[model samples]
Target: MMSNPEKTDLKNLTLPMLERFLQGRGKERFRATQIFKWIYQHDAGSFGEMTNISKDLRTELAETARISKLEPEAVEQGSDGTRKYLFSLGDGNAVESVLIPIEGRNTVCISSQAGCAMGCEFCLTGTFKLVRNLTTAEIVNQIMAIRCDVRAAGEEIRNIVLMGMGEPLHNLDNVIPAIQIMIDGNGLQLSNRRVTVSTCGLVPEMERLGRELPNVNLAVSLNATTDELRDRIMPVNRKYPLKELLRACREFPLPGRRKVTFEYVMMGGINDSLEDAKRLLRLTSDIPGKINLIPFNEHEGCGFRAPTQAAIDAFHTFLIDRNVTVITRDSRGADISAACGQLKGNLENRKEII
Candidate 1:
């Protein structure tokens, strides 16, 4: 008989670790690679799918380990090919992840925390309040689930962005392991250049990440130019001011030809002025970086409005004229509340299931 879903806690173990455990039990070590491929490359959700393993071994696996624990509770698909997946964690708490399909690349946005502690005024997740940080297994499960979905659609994923739900740096313990698992060449095999970690300026963590994981791209959510404005919009700035935050960036090691991304969300009359653009250019001038100007995505209770198109264009031009590299991020999934700050899983009317 198949064991109860709760019988195994294998979600936390890497393929090599699982193999070691099986070897300790007198099983052949090679079974580990077969099972690992099944879980990651082939999207095997249960031990029953590992047909090559003996039924006794499968039974042992069923009793000893769980391949995945998260269950998608709801899915919201936007008209622009963006899909928001809301997953129910083991404790019944929920979080959201987004899959965006661009011209030639498919990017999955994975969350690190259930809700956010960084009280960014315009973020919906922040409004709901912090719940808890997600486990490393739960974080890896999100990617595996998305990869399964992509394979079913006859497509392949090309990139990953750690820009969903919560501040990654704040949950470094789990986030670091999750990132390593995602980049493991024998597993997900995604190149470090293709992975980006976005933070709300957690200085110490940022510095640590630079020294510890220098390969992954770094993105700082620098919404404002001044400490006064930043402190108002992002409460974390109170602990690590703009000066200190920039200093950390300056000291961060960057790979050749790879530049750190500075994410600036444009809210009308808030941080979208030409003057703000100039200040941004000055702040990032010393560091090799590119600016991703995001148009604010709105929700019902959120008071911010996206900057006018003309204003956004002018801001882009201001940066370009100053010889700063910039790109106005194309907004996707706005209609389904899957864009930038639109992911709030509190909606009582969603009908799609995982």
Candidate 2:
């Protein structure tokens, strides 16, 4: 609300950094918890609404700090109850988040960058050039916005998937802090298991994530079994490749009883063959993980089509026969272009598909 005020964006600060910010302003460091609660828990958009804090302190905060907002451009609901929100950023660029609910749990898919640079041919997000990495506030704001939306609809979110738009590891500097806030006991209190970060096998970054945030679940987009196949579709594969990528997953310190999730998008005649499934099983044999078969979400110009139902079934059956834990994940929000690998915002420079 402060116009051109020299205040810091409070949402950008981690709890400890916020503690320092409050202390620097001559406020008690513990006050950061209260402010965090107001922003993340109470969903307060402005300092004045934190009525529990002293009015004088509220005025102080109003003058010295601000919470940035993402302008809502559109909200589309899939007939299956999934919702997609398009949020406009300050620079006129936009990003999207998808809210998916299943049975007792509500899962929100959040973006880490405006577009994507991973260049996975099957992903629609890959077509748009990577404009910029989302700041910590921009990343966290998407969750907060979705949180408010879900609560208003009388549902509580139980899971969060960093599976939208860009590669999360590419924006680790901002994404990790946002994840810390999501899993902070004093804040969103999301169980580490409930929050998953999906990546296209950013080997070193994945290792770094293991060291820094070991508790959160990880899902790798292992869409192809062979490096040659992967290289053509996922450029990151050229750098990390399958061997090194799976090695990181194997070495990752997953909490007891937790296994990494291998997300394999089923692209027809590309990587959905029954033999591919067998190879996939062998590829993941050494790693403790489950296979999530995502039938490709099709869009124009992507040049890839979804695997046929029989192909998908045969792959699923092969994995089942091999005694691998496999799940054919239901693709939600395709009706709204909000399914995995299908999110592309309506920025002026980006082509609006759908």
lDDT of each: 0.84, 0.88
Whose TM-score is greatest here? 2
Q: Which ten residues in a row have the lowest lDDT in candidate 1?
A: 345-354
Model 2: per-residue Cα lDDT over 128-172, one tens digit each: 879899988888888888888778879788999999989999999
C-alpha positional error of residue 350 in candidate 1 after TM-score superposition, expressed in Å = 5.5
RMSD of 2: 1.9
Q: For model 2, state the Cα shift of residue 264 in Å.
A: 0.3
Residue-pair clashes per candidate: 1, 0
Please give each candidate's TM-score. 0.91, 0.95
Candidate 2 backbone overlaps, count: 0
| After superposition, candidate 1 runs with Cα above 4 Å error | 1-8, 19-31, 52-56, 347-354
